[model samples]
Target: MIRTFGFPELLFILDGAKWTVLMSLAAFLFGGLLGLLVALARTSKIRPARFLALCYIQLFQGTPLLIQLFIVYFGLPIIGIRVELWLALITGLSLHASGFLAEIWRGSIQAVPEGQTEAARALGLGYISRMRDVVLPQAFRISLPATVGFMVNLVKGTALAALLGLTELTRAGQLMSNITFEPLKVYATVGLVYFAICLPLTLVSSRLERRLNARG
Candidate 1:
């Protein structure tokens, strides 16, 4: 029995879209926190800290995200730490995002004028205060465009969760296609849903870039 692609099917895909959004947000939130720490360490004066942070960034950036997902979803059980599908997916995505976001923020932190740091030092600010009150604020502004761009990529990346049996948007499409024998319709709808989610972020990234450049 081939069911037509109808409103119910569309709603099902949309339901999956919600999971996609939730996962992306969760990954971004956790990743951003860890990335900030990594960025700080990457830019630290301590050689060992910088070296370790560099290696951390390289490890994730060097590997395919799918491989990361596999390692998390499959490897953990071997170590006796079983994770649910959503937890595994979020963990893998967060780690991946942390590496990329760390680099983005490290560059942004460095891009802050050296004079700004000197001024903060001259004002007798300590390392934490300097970064918290002075450097990070500017870096945050500088990083907005790239961060949003990466977020757009992250949103697309969530589709990979389908491979791990998480019924995100792409997974939803997969099940729909299987049942309806309508891969074309199902995937086209998937693509449209992805576009709907990503286009605004894309536009925002571009706008932020232009604004930053204009200010520069």
Candidate 2:
């Protein structure tokens, strides 16, 4: 008798998707904090801080996340530091997001006219005060769209966590496909679920970008 894909299995898939969303949220919140610090360091006048940030961005951006996952999941255990697959995946994705985000924000911060920084300096504002009161607020507004876009990408990237054995959306699809013997259907459902999650974000980012541009 041929087995059919059923509602119970579909519910399981949906349940798995919740974890995917949660993991993405965790990755982004933690990564955004790290990225902000890296962005500041990248823009620092100190040569050592600048070099450290540059190397961090280069290391993560240059390597595929798959390899990084393997290193953390498998290789780290060799050194007696055993992290669960979920932990490893979150750590890897957070690091990857931080590297790219730092660059995006650094560019946005630099795009602010030099005269703006100079004008702040002319007001007797210290470096931290100038950046806090003047520079970063403007820079954050300019970078908001790109940051949203990055967040969307990070959501999709959670599928990669499946390789580390976390039962997220894609991995759940694989299990469903195995049982139902319907790879196309299972993966199509997975893709649709991902689209449902990501589409609104795309629309929101576009609308925000247009509004920002119009104001400019």
Candidate 3:
């Protein structure tokens, strides 16, 4: 029973964008915090800390997120650990984001000169104080563009949540397309909605990159 592609369907699809945005936000916030820890650990003086962080980053970064999500959501139940859909989605996304962010922040941290760290130490500042006062601020500025670019990728990655039966933007589009039998229209709208959300982010990221380069 095919229906017409109408404004109401379009409106419903638009409404679903809220979930996508929310999911992305949750993933980013939680992931960013965790990633900061990973970055610090990755750069830590302790060999064990670095090794463990490396394993974590490689495990998450090397694997397909779809399989990770499947393991978290489906494979877990086989081992008697029941997982919630949203929880699995957020967890998978968080791990994925954290691994990459850790590397990004780590590189940014390393890019800061050794002399600055030594100078901060000469001022009698401790590790946290040195990073807080001198190192991280600059590293953050250097890393901002890449971080924003990764965020844009994260926004697009939210579509994978549809596989979990979540009626996020992509899932909503799929359902509507089925009912309306208008794959072209529905998908075009979906792409447009994603573009509307991501295009601004892309522009801002580019502008920031240019500004960073200019300042550098």
Candidate 4:
């Protein structure tokens, strides 16, 4: 039963953007936390922690996100485990983002001058205090632009959530296109919606990068 691509369909598709926003937020918040831990572990003095963190990063970063999403949604059930759509999507995206962010932030941390760490050590600051009070702040500023860039990609990654029955923007567009028999219009709208969401972040990332360079 085909229908027309009209105002109502457009509104419905736009409404689905909310879910995309939610999923992106979920992935970023959780993934950022995980990435922080991973970054710390990667930089840890412990050989085992560094090795395990590296393995985790390689496992996630080396794989395609679509395959990871599939493994979460479909593979878990095969192993006698089941997760709801929201959890599954967040898990996949968060793990993906964590890998990249951990590496990104690790670089940021390393980029901070060794002299600062030595000064912190001279001041009797423990490793935790050194990182929390001295290092992470500088590293965060350095990593900000790259972090935002990754987040822009994560926003786009939410489109993949549609594959697991989530009614995100892309999925909504697909469903509308099916009924409206208007793939071109519906998908064009979807692309426009994505552009609208990502363009600002892209601009913001670039601006921040320029500022960082200016400071340097």
**The candidate that achieves the highest lDDT relative to the unseen native structure:** 1
Off by over 4 Å in 1: 205-216
Clash list (residue pairs), candidate 2: none
Q: Say what the RMSD of model 1 is.
A: 1.8
Q: What are the clash counts of all predictions, listed in order?
A: 0, 0, 0, 0
What's the best-to-worst order under lDDT? 1, 4, 3, 2
Model 3 agreement with the true structure over 104-171: per-residue lDDT tens digits: 99999999999999999999999999888899988988888889889989999999989889998999
Report the lDDT tens digits of candidate 4 across residue range 96-129. Answer: 9999999999999999999999999999999899
lDDT of 2 at 131: 89
- When summed lDDT is taken over every stretch of 10 residues in candidate 4, the lowest stretch is 207-216
Candidates in order have lDDT scores of: 0.94, 0.88, 0.91, 0.92
Q: For residues 112-182, could you state the per-residue lDDT of candidate 2 as single tens digits?
A: 88999999999999989988998998898789888988898889888888877788899999889988998
Query: How well does each candidate superpose onto the true structure, as a TM-score?
Result: 0.94, 0.92, 0.93, 0.91
Q: In candidate 3, what residue range of length 10 has the lowest lDDT sum?
A: 207-216
lDDT of 2: 0.88
Residue pairs whose backbone atoms clash in candidate 1: none
Q: Which TM-score value belongs to model 4?
A: 0.91
Residue 24's lDDT in candidate 4: 89
